[model samples]
Target chain A: MMVMTQENLTSKERFDKIFEVEFLPQIDALYTFAYHLTYNEDDANDLVQETYLKAYRFIEKYIEGTNAKAWLFKILKNAFINQYRKKSKAPTKVDYEEIINFHDEENDTNYSTHTDLREEMFQSMMGDEVTNAINALPVDFRVVILLCDIEGFTYEEISKIIDVPIGTVRSRLHRARNMLKGQLKTYAESLGFKDKRSKD
Target chain B: DYQELVRKVTMYLDNELSEAEAYLKVLSQEKSFREFIKSKLHRRKPSPALIKSIKDKIKT
Candidate 1:
């Protein structure tokens, strides 16, 4: 959080300083988020560009010393919701029951044997799979999870950014995690790492 | 019970709970829960290429 003295500098100077100091460091994180939300590289770039342009135009109104990332995220989230997400639907839907039943079928496989391999394999596989699973979440859940889990924002910060109550953030994060866990479980089973503890 | 367990594990994973409380809650769970927490805590970061693309976009 960098503070700009409103009285000391010209508006353009202030904007440039803020952009250089506060916004630039967070650009990568913001783009990653936009990319995940849009699921298209080009669209993600455009969305992030638009977000920055809006943030710059409205720069004078932004209070100094506030959470810059959250402010930027608010701008980005609103842009995504009002403009982009409204025009698109999820590419696919996965049934949780089907995943669970599939895990049940693989109950005979041993988890312990794969526990060592699990770490390395999962580490390599998780980034793409997690991104895919997150992108597949409903709009609300996806936003909440991205803010809380991926971007590492606090619940209060997310509340302010998304203009939602803290309770909603909690519930949405909970649901999102469960959905993610279900997806990961299915992914693990597909890789033949059965939950041996299920038998116990 | 499963929901409660999930909530506890999630809170613990996020470090939202106090250490003593998290320890107590986590101690009561099955071995799988512990393993789950360990795996999750150690999950890999996003790819460098993904991160690089983001940085490149931001720089432009």
Candidate 2:
């Protein structure tokens, strides 16, 4: 077995420390990401299980002071993609050039949807509405939003986790938020929140 | 200008910018924008049994 050169623990102790500290605490976060990707509890649990298995086997490569969360997230994302590829019998379709080339507001056809709405408008937005809106987004856009908004990862960190450029992370987030804004507005309006712009 | 505002807001949200940045100052005053940024999405937790299963695998 390979050793972590910088860490003080021996191999057995290192495995225990990695699990107790770095890996176990992140199971919730990893499961959340996996759930959003698969939208199935069993598949998500399987993905998380596989991720920890792989992380355990390769624990020697994990630098001690580095971002353990980001490393695990990268592994989870890759596992999700691999499973997706195998099930689909095709490569995961990513149009990186399109994501890279698209302008943030080019297709923001709902620009004035809820931009002027107040905080009270969203107070009535139940978690189910928010969850459904996020789940409805395309996976690329959804992943960035989950990482940045829900999980609160930095753009640079998300870019590394998802294997995209920082610019792409920004573009995807902008688009995702815009999409969510429109969807959430529909739910809010349904729940009796007025679009202030509709008043104007 | 909207794109620039988004960039600034994103940078601010991620703590990449100083709190004193002018755009962030304006953003801080916008309660609605703050609500939007709050992203009240539901996050699911893994089952305890699954966690136990993984831990068992790791220990073996």
Cα lDDT computed for each candidate against the true fold: 0.69, 0.76
**Model 2 lDDT on a 0 to 1 scale:** 0.76
lDDT string for model 1 (A103-176, tens) is 87567476556665868766675566555676678899988877766677888889999998978888888887
lDDT of 2 by residue, A1-200 (tens): 97546555466796688778977899889998898788778889899999999998898899876899999999998898788778789666777776764555456765346443534454554346766777789878988877876688988899999999988887887788778768888776676654453211
Cα distance off (Å), candidate 1, residue A157: 0.9
What lDDT does candidate 2 reach at residue A117?
A: 58
Candidate 1 wrong stretches, greater than 4 Å = A1-9, A85-129, A192-200, B18-60
The global Cα lDDT (0 to 1) of model 1 is 0.69
The TM-score, computed over Cα atoms with residue i paired to residue i, of candidate 2 is 0.71
Q: Write the per-residue lDDT of candidate 2 for residues B1-60, one digit (tens) a residue.
A: 345675676566667676546544445533354355354556788998998898888777
DockQ, per model, reads 0.17, 0.42
What is the RMSD of candidate 2? 13.6
Which clashing pairs does model 1 show? none
